[model samples]
Target chain A: MTGETVMFWVLAPLTVFAAVGMLLVKKAVHSAILLAFVMIALAIFYIAQDAPFLGIVQIVVYTGAVMMLFLFILMLVGVDSSDSLVETIKGLRGVAITTSLAFAAALTSLIARAEFGQEPLGLVSANANGNVEGIANLIFRQYVWAFEVISALLITAALGAMVLAHSPKSSEARLSQRARSVARFRGASIGTAAGLPGSGVFARHNAVDVPALLPDGKPSDLSISSVLAERGDVQETKRYALDGLPKLDEEDK
Target chain B: MTEYASLLLDDPIWLVAVKALLIFVLCVLLTLLAIWGERRIVARMQLRVGPNRVGPFGLVQGLADGVKLALKEDLIPKAADKVIFIIAPIISASTCFLAFAVIPMTGKVLFFGEETVFQLTDLSVGVLYILAAASVGVYGIVLAGWSSGSTYPLLGGLRSSAQVISYEIAMGLSFVAVFMYAGSMSTSEIVDSQAQWWNVVVLFPSFVIYVISMIGETNRAPFDLAEAEGELVGGFHTEYSSLKFALFFLAEYVNIMAVSALATTLFLGGPAAPPGLSFTESWLGGWFTFIWFILKVALFFFLFVWLRGTLPRLRYDQFMKFGWKVLIPVNIAWILIVATLRLMTQEGASQFMLAGFIITVVVLVMLATTIYESSKAKAEAAARFVPEMPEPSFPVPELPKQKRVEL
Candidate 1:
């Protein structure tokens, strides 16, 4: 194998492996990180192809932008421990393994039929790396339609992503909230005592610690600060959360 | 390709690696300096010293601050996802640093006996590489925000991801015009093809689009919603402390410098002297080429600084609308115009006829733009003149109320 070919074969499998691993990863955030490794490897592949621009674009766009979006979303939604791959595929393991093997077999056949070129193509050697002048001629005349098609695809994808990113949290909460919110009053019984601040996650979801309505239905603006202050003040805040979890354990046992 | 004895040996892998390392270091240094320069320049524009003390000329101030950040206890919020919290910044910093490998700073230079291109590598799909790199860079911000396991950071990351995506399309389209005009996407080839007229001149519309898109892509001022200092409170990096925060900052500034360098290369001509000087045979010509490159890059850098100082950040909605409604569509129309020009040239159409067609297209575009601007302005004025709506007792959240809890 040529140095270029050697570089590519080694890197390409790693890239594909990482990308597949990203798909298989349980934690959404971890999946995003795996996707980044795949993206970086793909960029190296682009560099090997003598397409530095595309490699940079791959890194900048897929690794930087798209994966970041995925990560942000995972973060935004709160880590979905429920979506853990192992957990998701618990019952489907046998079928999944069979399907994956079938897919791999088909892929191998396709690769086996591909023709090999005798020599490595280089921007320097061939001056035929067929860059600006070559692409200009080809794009203007031959591949113009393909170019426009890609642009259209990009436009739709951009809009779709934006819409998805901005999706409201309403349906998620209303539909799945009760099942998932678990509020961990789980099969594990909770103490009847409710006044201890961090009995549950202690409002990890919201930072907006405003006042509540009094029993008399009067506004209690004064209590907002007082309540919030007491939650943290002379009494150390960290202990409440640490202390809260064990209390549930005690009640359950 | 002629193999360089200096570079081909095992020792030189380390050497090239060292050089690459130096370039990365220089880029980060430049970014910090640019940040300081931007502040000081803006302060001068507004009549103030940006960051005096810490060191003379505040020269050492950026460095001093960097050292201070390093010395400070690296605080990992107890709530943050520990592994990702560490990895995200590395991704951002490394990707930004890697982008420089392809940018031709001073064109070809002698190394040992062989002629060597100043670029780290060339690729037929070079432009696409850049786009991909930038896309990956966003992950760092988004992941950092998400892994922080904090509300604000998550929100900031989400917003940033959206912002980058929205602008990236326009940025890609902007490059299409360059690709069309130059014919190749290779950095060196594109630079070479602009032997006569820098694509900036021939493809001025594309140049304008690229300039706008580059700013938006880099998340510069007026478009920096990802880390909106005012609202998100340092945005994605809000949960970060010490070296983590510095990495994010370094990535931001380094990316800024990379994009500026890219703009200078693509539009202004990479490392080549300006048209007149490159062609001139004087010993001064070669010397001047390096000088011209730095000058051009500096100018573009200054523009970034100026925009940060002058423009207030756009509202998130308006920013997206501008990208989708204005920039993308306008780029499409401009591409059509460029396509027509390319067709005419290919068909061996008469120069006069082509010129007339071009003139007509230019006039129509300008007229349309003017009419659109007037209508937009008129709408703005009419809205302002109309009575403001009474404050609602409870302003409806833009997001669905059900989301209020999940969010």
Candidate 2:
């Protein structure tokens, strides 16, 4: 097989698998990652098809910008939040299945009927004056209005987001609150004293200011102590508390 | 494909493999040298002695570290996603190598009785290919963080992804001017276009922006907040150990080299000799151009190390703000001016007049905006003024004065 054919065969299946995996993956993060893989695969496919401009655009725009945004949002939301399996709306799953099946069938039929070897009308070969120039020509000349409209739509979307998220009165109130907090903080010593507990069992000082010492003369409520206590591994704790602090004897009380 | 690039495809399979192998070896050796150089340079900057034990001047210290890492016990956190944890470092290290594939090391050189460019491969969209590879490298870090199932790592990964995305936008915008000037994205073609003047000379603003964005993009010092040791404690690789950790380290240094090479390719004219220098060209039978390329790349590497030694990491918010607000907007404006000038010059217009006109317009617009912004700020300050509060109704208790004791 030719290199292009070989590449197509490899990348096409991988792309399909990744697309399917994106839906099948339980974790939202994994799905987002799989979508990125799909995008990269599609970009390779574009390159193999001699459309270097489209391939690069696919990578730069879809895989790089959009998928990164998706992953960013997903990670921020936390990976523990998996996709809910429950059907929120009655008959929604059925509707989805039906629509997807119909769409798939329509797409399959359209592809099967399409001419594979012939170049499309008004579309220049990628080798002619470079793919970038050819694509630019098409974009700025033939499809200029559509491109402009799409860009305008993006701007409008951004505006709508601002309108939805912003409120002048609330923002002003928040700003005033923030100013007050800042003033309060400035009036006091910029220390951890504000977070200290008032009292504790071994309270010589505030709990947050000074960690309480346990009867064993080890610091109480430390991360190591908590983790060890949770795991019920007290024997392992001795290795961690090897700082050579004197242990409190029972008679010393 | 351009004639320069076409020859690359016509190379025999074994030659291509040899070139790929050479690139791999060069990247690794550069990473090692960079590590040693960074340590030695930073130590000198700090007035301290660096590694001098392993080999002469600690040149083999990187090798020692590699051996040490390989010998160390590999540890996987109990909660980590096993598959992803394994794949993450591989992704990082591989992508670092991938970006070097299109970087031309030298002009046409005789290879076993055939002329070929000193590069692995040349794509039509070579620069974009590098960018794509760099972008994909983000995945390795993000995945490593997420798969660790830890807090600091997740935060680091998130920070890095956001940082990469923000900087990538600026970096891409900066490239637009270079593309306009070069009239092609292919690295070899760009190098050819720089026969008269390097892109850095013509597209100074883009170069500046690219340098800043490259630093941010590579997550080097001053922009390495993702792995800020003071806060994140090793960051995304916190949960990794042994060879995996080494992979992350290797990827980091390789990324530095790749980015430096890219800057060399795009701005410093990619293996081309400096203008009006022909003595060195004949000294090594024309192989001296490769040395020039290496020197330019090394200079960039030194700059990276110097910044690391001199500067402190930027706060995350400030870094993001600079990337999105300052670098990107400035890059866009610069690109617009450059593109206009290029079009005018191409159409037989006076280059000086067109450039001057664009610069004048840009300056006037900037001045107008600055004045308007300052006035608006003054108005806001006036509007935000608050009257002082009256005295409290309840009497405040006064503390008793401490008795003065003189020692």
Candidate 3:
């Protein structure tokens, strides 16, 4: 077998497995990652098939930009958000299964009836100048109209996203830096005028979980982060107080 | 496949393995040297002593650090994703080395009596392959951050992915100018086309854009917001320890070298000698060209170090704004001009026409920028104007007279 054949055999199974795993993965992030794997594998297949331009574009546009964005949104939404599996619409599962089976059967029959040789027809002549130039010629000449339409569609999609995301400024005039500073200084309590003390300030222990100590030997509530406090990860300062520690000489006895 | 690719295709299996091994060693060695050089250079810039302990001039400091890291206790956070946490660093380290495959480090040379180019494989879309490798490299960072199951890592991961994705567009757009000039994406062909003049001279704007984008793409200062130490506390690797942390570090340095080498290939004309010293290319059976390649790559590495030493990390919002609003738009405009110029030249436009076209475009761009700047300034001034202050409604308190007593 040729190297390409060997590579195809090695990668084809892995690609299928990854693609299937993408659907089965519990976490949305995992599914996204599996899909990325499948996309990359498909890119390799393209390169192996002598379509290096398509292969690299696959990786760049799909795995790189699109999948990264997918993962980014998943991260923002929370990685623990998994496939619901719950049927939101009535008879949705039945419809999905029927459609997928019909599509698979149609695909199989079409491939079986296709009049192609065992060996792939390589793009050796078409890519005589270079794969990039060959693809460029096709894109700018033969498929120019389609390409233009696709670009228009992309621009419209981008505009739609921007419009959806854009939030109109409120009627209230935005506060200037000077106004913000003046308001802060003139506010109800002057305690946080400079800013709240950072966590672990004057606490000896510099970890974020430790709250700063007040002058009256009390822990300052404002010093520790609310997140840590709410998570119950805060360390009690009394345990590390100097008075509570054993003396070195007493420990020797 | 191009000539270099056909040459690579004729390679024996053993020779191919050797080439792969050589590329692997080159990358790892470059990573180590980059780490050492960055420290020494930054130290000099800061007027401080860098690593001088262990091997002479601390040349093996990176190696020593690697060993120490290996020997240290490996820690996995209780809440971390076990499988992905383990795979993340491996993915990070591997994808970085993959980019070197398409990067031609030298011209034809004899490797164990086999004539081969000093590259693993030269795909027709070689440059795109590098970009693909870089894009895949992002997964390593993102996954490391996510699988760590911590807040800081997640934030750092998101920042890095966003930064890389934003900058990759500008970087890709910059390459379009070079592709136009060379008329091919294969690394070797591009290098060959630059025999007369380097792309750095012909495509200066693209070079500048690529340099800036590469810096941001690699997450180096002043674009290192993703792993800002003051904020993220070691960023995505906060939850990692020992060897896993080392793998991330390795990947970071390897990525630096990868992009630097790519910059050298695209802008500095690959492994070609200096213009005046072009004769030296055929010297030593074409092996000396590898030295020139190293020198060019080293120059870029120094630039990376210099920027890191001189600049401060940018604010996240401002950095994002600069990438999207500044770098990308400029890059797109440059690409359009380049494409039009290429088209005109190919259509056999007269010299006078080409010059006039270029001059008109330049003047128009300048005028548009000036107008845009003036309008923006006016809007900013209007926004800064504060309304007239009103007099206090309540009466002001009178100061006590002659209350001070001299001691």
Candidate 4:
């Protein structure tokens, strides 16, 4: 077998596995990651088929921007929010299975009946002037109108998203930085006027989880983030204490 | 097809393997040097001696650091997803090296009695391949953040992903001009097309946009919001320790080199000798071209270090705004002008006419910018002129009715 066929045999099963894994994965983040893998594998297939331009675009546009955005939203929405098995719509699973099966069968039949006039003609001749140039000629010359229409459509979609996402600014006067600072100092207590002390400011260990030590040799509750404290991720300060140094009382004596 | 691509295609399997290995080693070595160079250069810029105690001139300081990092205790946070946490760095480190595959690092040179270029392979879509590799690299940081199962890392990861996405658009837009001018995306062809004048001179705006975009792309300062130490702790690698953290560090530096090399290839003319130094191209059996390439990359590397030393990190909102609102629009406008110029040249426009066209475009752009700035300033001034300040009103609670008796 040729190297291309060998590579195809190696990658096809993995791509399929990853695609299937995306659905089976419990976590949305993992699903997104698996989808990225599938996209990358498809990109390789494109490259192997002599469509290097499309292959790279598959990677740049799909795996890169699109999948990254998917993962980004997943992170924002909380990655731990796993899929719910409970169907929200009545007979949804049945409908999904039936449609998927029908689609698969149609795809199989289409592939089976596909005709090859002779030995397949590769893109070598078309890409003689370089893949990008060849594609550009098609895009800018023959199919320019179609390309322009597609671009217009994309721009419209982008604009639509912008309009939907945008919210009008509040009518109330916004506080300037100076005003905010002045208000901060004048509020309930000025104890934290400058700012709340950062975690591990005066601690032996300066890790984020290590709470700073107060003057009386006690850990300050306000030093570490409340989230971290709530989660019980804070490190024990006893081991990190500067025991080698003389005590304050002894120094005073 | 370019000479380099054709040559690369004819390379036997063993030669391909050797070239791939060579590229991998080169990247790793460059990463090490980059790390040390960044520290040393930044230190000198700040008037401090850096890493002087390590091997000669601290040349092997990065190696020392690698060893130290590997030997350090590895920690996996209790909450982290184990499998993904391990894979994240591998993906990052691997993809950075992948970008090097298409970058022409030298002129045609003899290696082991076979003629080859100092590159793994050159795709017809070479520039796109580099960009694709870079995009894939984002997954490393994102996965690192997500799998860490921590707030800081997660926030860092999201910020990085967003930053990369926005900047990648501007970066791609900048490349549009280069592609239009060169008429090819292959790195070698682009380099060859710049025989007389580099893209940096002809496509100055694209170069500027690309340089800015690349800094943001690699997550370097002042665009290094991904690892903003103050706010996000260690950012996406907050929970990473030992070798995993080292991998991220290696990937970060290697990515810087990758982008720098790309900048060299696209704008500076990859592996080409500087002006008035044409004779040097024949030196060392064309291996000198590799040296020239490295010098160009080093120039960019120094720029990265200088920026890191000089500029403070940009606020995340401002950085994002700059990328999307400013850089991208400017890039698109530049591409339009470039495309028009390319078309004019293709249609045999005279030098006088071309010069006049360029002058007209520049003047119009300048005039528009001035007008926009003035209008923005006027709006700001008008907004600042508030008529009066409202009385500060805060909610107050009344004392309990029976409080006096209770007290």
Candidate of highest TM-score: 3
Scored against the true structure, residue A45 in model 4 reaches a CA lDDT of: 92
| Model 1 C-alpha lDDT versus the unseen true structure | 0.71
For model 4, what is the error of residue A186's alpha carbon versus the real structure, in angstroms, after optimal superposition? 13
| Worst 10-residue lDDT window, candidate 2 chain B | B391-400
Summing lDDT over every window of 10 consecutive residues in candidate 3 chain A, give the lowest-scoring window.
A240-249
Lowest lDDT block of 10, candidate 4 chain A: A240-249
Model 3 scores a C-alpha lDDT of 0.86
The segments of candidate 4 whose C-alpha lies over 4 angstroms from its true place after superposition are: A89-125, A172-253, B350-356, B386-407
Task: Provide the clash count, candidate 4.
Answer: 0
lDDT of 3 at A164: 96
Residue-by-residue lDDT tens digits, candidate 1, B169-218 = 88888888888776666677777777788878888878898889888888
- Each candidate's fnat, in order? 0.35, 0.26, 0.37, 0.40
- Categorize the docking of model 2: incorrect
Tens-place lDDT digits, model 3, residues A1-253: 9999999999999999999998887888888889999998998898887788899999999999899988888888885566788889999999999999999999999998998666764677877876777888999999999999999999999999999999987997786776556655555434567788787644586588776655434556677788887898876756543344344445555
lDDT of 2 by residue, A135-239 (tens): 889899999999999999999999999999987674433334444455444544223226432223345533332344443444434423344456765333233
Error of 3 at B267 (Å): 0.7
**Per-residue accuracy of model 1 over A47-98 as CA lDDT, tens digit each:** 6666555566567666665666566556656654437345465659888789
Candidate 3 has a TM-score of 0.85
